[model samples]
Target: MTKLIGALDQGTTSTRFVIFDDTGAIVTFHQIEFEQHYPHPGWVEHDPFELLDSCRLCIEHAVNKLIKLGYQVSDIEGIGITNQRETTIAWDKKTGQPLYPAIVWSDVRTQNTVDQLSKKSPKGVDALRSICGLPLTTYFSAIKLRWLLDHVPAVAQAREHDRLVFSTVDSWLIFHLTGGLENDGVFVTDVTNASRTMLMDIHSLSWSNESIRFFGFEGIELPQIKSSSCIYGHIKQGALTGFAIAGCLGDQQAALVGQKCFETGTAKNTYGTGCFMLFNLGDAIPPVLSHNGLLTTVAYQLGKDQRPVYALEGSVAVGGSSINWLRDNMHLISDHHQLNELAASVEDTGGVYFVTAFGGLFAPYWKVDARGTICGLTQYTTRAHLARATLEAACYQSKAVLDAMNKDSGTPLRALNVDGGMSNSDLCMQIQANLLGDGVLVTRPKMRETTALGSAIAAGLALGVWKDLNDLDKVNKEGETVFRSQLSAESTERLYSGWQKAVTRSLDWAEPVDEKLE
Candidate 1:
């Protein structure tokens, strides 16, 4: 019987379940798009029940598809989970009920909380960077958790009762999958996810007492941190019952593993709802933190005894979601495919530049006060130019991150392995290559479901289906499309310069206001 692994990819906008054979080829899969709740300006949320139900539905549907293909559920040796990191969830350990809506990672409602915390720290927002590998920003879990405790009465009540359990999406899923309130479900988080919380000591791979006190979360219950690839628990009920849940990783770090970037100096950029670029730094944690606004994060820990791998990550707050903005908000295109078609119709942005700081800029510039801005627009500009500019906005942000990575690493990124939704566009890839300039390559694998494949690999590693990283040599190595610079260095520089100017117009657009916790 062929060994199969199931990977659950719970993301910002959707959830998916994929079953992969031992060779890394996908056998079956199912994806469901869930509702995104925006209660207030700059705030984002999701129904915790809705997220959990979507995962259950995706798993059932995928397993059904696998059965139709004459495969048994027993053929699947284990399961892995990869999720959106820093999206905070609070629940009651006694009843297993969510205290409030999941506070999305993109939500800037905690800006006031961030400001207050920054004031308390002598080093300001960067006081915790040396310990947690993250700044005290609204982009992390600890900040979101802080907001919940300060504002939400239910969360505060749960804490008062000593029933509050705080975790990212991964631990929430694992807890329910293992047993929930009935069986006393295992509550745990992997190093990659914990590293995003601004609560974990990156070097120790454990929760930091200093960070916990700094955030004033001394009494709150945090999930135990574990290796990225290990048997977290097993499904107690459902079609996947008794299957070992072996692996867990944050979505971007999972993409790094999926891309097989095992060597130092290797990197991959995932352009999903947001763009994340991670450059592997190998075994040791760097003593110094990034001065260029990039975050230091754990890449992965394959086993409990294995040494943790580290990375320098650059996050772009907007990526393919900018295309969604053009479609849903501006009504420029009916769908993403139409956006690409319209963009290809235009030669260039026609001197227009768009700064997609919808939730403020991240990486290379932690401008929480920044807002979206479009500059250099003229009467000559059309919908086509706007569409192309939207796409170019993502590419420009990615290039900015790549440049910052080069500066921090002291080595130029020669090639970037690309994946996720935006990478499917040939036009977008060409634009990215054009901006990256000569000698740099952007490679996209034919198997674009790398996020899922990565989790499957992690699961398989723990289950001994594959012994080590070298064992995955032939997995997902079938074929790839490589893109090189098509534009001159002068043109690339000019375009980037305009993008920089547009970004400047976006900074400090929103004034700091005291947000009421209602």
Candidate 2:
């Protein structure tokens, strides 16, 4: 049997499993899409048990495919986990029963909590942002943790008894897969994931006492910190018994790591349910931050003296999910793949532009109440026009971020390493380059899921299947698809200016006047 590694990419909307051979190419893959729960208008959640089961199903199905192709399950060498960041989960420490549904990052139900805390503890907020490079928004995990602790009775009860163990998704998976509470199943998170919690110190890369108290919690309630490239725990049982889980990361950080953009000015953009751009900063943290509404974060930490790498991040807040909303809510297309085909059918958007601010604007604009809008629509508009516009909207949002990064960093973008589902579209990459006036490079990964690859890279190195970052880096530098900019200055500027106008028209006009973004 050929040596292979299995990567589990447990994301916001789906769980995907992929096996990569020693030479670094995918031998087989499987994916299982699951349900997203919206219990209330702004409250988003996931069934914890169902989340665990789907991850199992994804791995099992993918392994079965390998078996059918005459590959033994034993051929799998390691497991790496990359998951959605900042979603909070509270569960019984002894029973592994969730005290509440996983509070998804998109859930804005905690807006009041955020605003209340913003006024109640302005100093704490400033300290946290200064140390953590994040704001006291409803989006981070610190406030969400507070929301559950204060509002959910079971959670409050469990916390009082020290029975409620709080964790991000990685901790829950490690707990469940390694025999839950019975086995002392490891409860550790990497620096990348820990950075998003609003609990971690970006400089120290550990749970912060000040922030935890600020969140009204204790550090004892948090997970252990581990290096990104180390054996954090083991899978004590299951289909792949005796296997080690040597890797973990919040999904976006994993994407950045997986892309191998490690130096200053080196960056990556992921086009998943949303679009995110991460710029790597070597050892030093920027004393001053200008977000343009994007977050500045810890890229990763390594070695005995490995200083924390900082990254400036920008999020578009919607990409594939917008296509999903169109199909599910508006019946604009039958499926997501159909969007690619439909978009290619149109020569252009036919004077139409779509600003998919369904959730809100992220990166460059943090208007939480802005709703989606389709502008420049004319009688000539067709489904194909909307489809093209949707795709361009994603690219346009990415460009806006690159522009912002340039402004903040005062350095021009070098080559952008791209990954994620939408990056598969040459049309999207070409459009991205034309507008940004820079080259966009996509990796020819053994698997399309960079999040999982990141996990595997960390895990394998930690487990000694690979020796160190040097060993892993050698593998990642192999082959890449680079899309070069070929657009005239005038045309690109015209399109981008129009996109900005479209975004303006989508702002929270319906929101309370006081809450509106200026």
Clash list (residue pairs), candidate 2: 25-446, 26-446, 292-364
Residue 243 shift from truth in candidate 2, angstroms = 1.0
Superposed on all Cα atoms, the candidates' RMSDs to the truth, in angstroms, are 1.1, 3.3
Q: Pick the candidate with the highest lDDT.
A: 1
Candidate 2 lDDT over 1-518, as tens digits, reads 44688888888999888787755577888988889986655567998888889888887788888899997888888888888898889888767789888998877777667767877664644547877788877678877888887788888888778787878888888778887777777777888888888888877787888877877786236778887766666777667777877777788888887877777888888999898899876677553365465677887765334677788898888888888888998898998789889998987898788888766677778777777899998889999999989999999999888888888888888688888888888787787888877444433343456777777776666666666666665555566677777877888888889998988899865342232111
Q: Please give the CA lDDT of all the candidate structures.
A: 0.92, 0.78
Superposed Cα deviation of residue 219, candidate 1 (Å) = 1.8
Worst 10 residues of 1 by lDDT: 509-518
TM-score (all chains, Cα) for each model: 0.98, 0.93
